[model samples]
Target: MDIRQLKYFVAIVDAGSLSKAAQKLYIAQPSLSQQMAALEDELETQLLLRSARGVKPTTAGHALYQRARAILRQMEQLRADVREDGGSESGMVAVGLPTTIAAVLAVPLFEHVRKHFPGIRLQIFESMSGYISEMLPDGRLDLAILFRDSETHGMSVIPAFDEELYVFGHAGLKLRKTATTCPLSALAGVPLVTPGTVNNLRLLIERTFLREEVELHIVGDIDSLPALMAIAHGGSACTILPASAMLHRAENARPPMRRIVAPDMSRPASVCWSHALPVSAAALAVRKAMVGLIGQLHADGRWPGITLRPPPDAATLEDTSGSV
Candidate 1:
């Protein structure tokens, strides 16, 4: 019936339980239940299905949830615009980063936003790139760094950089030492742990192998970065990933890494946001900050195996520029 009720409903659906949502919203359970009841009554239809296991949204509830999220985002953007009218930017900006990219960029990006745009609150969601890509279209994320090859319909995408993939494993794996890069053929018989089939990186690797007529012996299909790294560290199997994925590890603690040759491999990363939603000043500020920090990192030699894309054209730059 009201924005407050919609917020409560969204919270309940997200938390999957009234008690949990109530705790998160700092409200009494009975009060939350009553509010939901009132909303359902006003709607003239049942919205949620309750059971011992918890709650799930009905068809009508799901439809309302999507619209409510969009409405809330618009309200937030309006508030941000009003706040920035006085020459100060303030609002929440949600950014999505893949696990590998997060290892290299999350901390620096967070610090940069806090130091430069002190009035803006940054929310960094770290997950698999595939999962992160799914959140951008629904107004859940203000911006995301995703693979350039991702499904980006109805979104604005800015190419950021190209990152080379490498083979990583412990010394015990007995991977032949290469002066600079290892041939893709050398890994034909090596046992490997990689992401699942649905992952973009996995698909790329598969296509490359198929095109090159090389045999890829995958021993495990693990989508988690840490788990894959652990399997490689244990000398059980090697993994292929961007060098940025190991940026958080100390040099001595890092596994051996070698660039893949015999037709080098790399993937492009991009900054993306939905075209259907209004981007707030806070979000724009964060996006600019992210791009600048990425360039700085490449220039400082902090980010490895990555080539920064050239600057945007005059027209593109003009489109992205704002008062923030």
Candidate 2:
């Protein structure tokens, strides 16, 4: 019915109990319940189903919960814009990164915001690319670094870079120390641990292997990057991922890494934001900062195994300016 009621409803849904929501909102439980009742009355529909266990949103409540979150985000962005107009950019900007990319970029991005955009608060979510992809379109994340194959309808996607996949494992693995690359056929019988099929990187690996007529002996499915690396380092199974995934470790301590070749495989990373939502000044600033940081990292060779994609405008200009 109103913004306050919507907020209360969302809190209730998230907390799953009136008492819990009341505690979170710092209001009385009865007051919260009354607000919910008023909201349901105004809408002429039951929003939530109550029970001894807890509460769950009805179908309409689920729908309103999604729209309420987006509306709340917009309202916050409106406030941020007003503050930006007063000469300082200040607001929360949520950015999502896949686990592997987070290993290389998270801290640098956090420090960059702290130094350059003092008033802007950075909320970075590091998870599976699949999860991050789900958040970006619903206003839960202002921006995200997602793979090219991600579901991206109604979103503006900018190519960031292409990173080559590599085979990594402990010294006990069958990999040759003298070789810098491993042929796709070499891994046909190798025990491997990889992210599940839902992950873009995993999907890419699967498609590549299938097309090349190579069979993969996937021993385990690990969505967590750290756990996958640990399994590989312990000689449980070799894992395939970009070199950037190991950037957090000391160079000397890194596991054996060999680029996948004989038809090298790579995945394109893209910066994405919802086209339906109005991006705030703070979000825009963070996006620029992230792009510039990626460029610098690539230029300095700090982030390796990646070829930066040129800006869309540059690509367009080159296309139109080609010699006849």
- Give the best candidate by lDDT: 1
- Give Cα-based local distance difference scores for all models: 0.82, 0.82
Determine the backbone clash count of candidate 1. 0
Cα-based TM-score, every candidate: 0.87, 0.85
Q: Poorest 10 consecutive residues of model 2 by lDDT?
A: 315-324
Best TM-score among the predictions, by candidate number: 1
RMSD (Å) of each candidate, 1 decimal: 3.2, 5.3
**Native-to-model Cα distance after best TM-score fit, residue 155 in candidate 1, in Å:** 1.3
In candidate 2, which residue pairs clash?
none
Candidate 1 residues 193-274, lDDT tens each? 8998888899999999999998988989998998888777777888999998788876766777888888899999988877
Candidate 2 stretches greater than 4 Å from native = 12-23, 27-34, 46-59, 83-88, 149-151, 170-174, 251-253, 314-324
Estimate the overall C-alpha local distance difference test score of candidate 2: 0.82
Candidate 2 accuracy as TM-score: 0.85
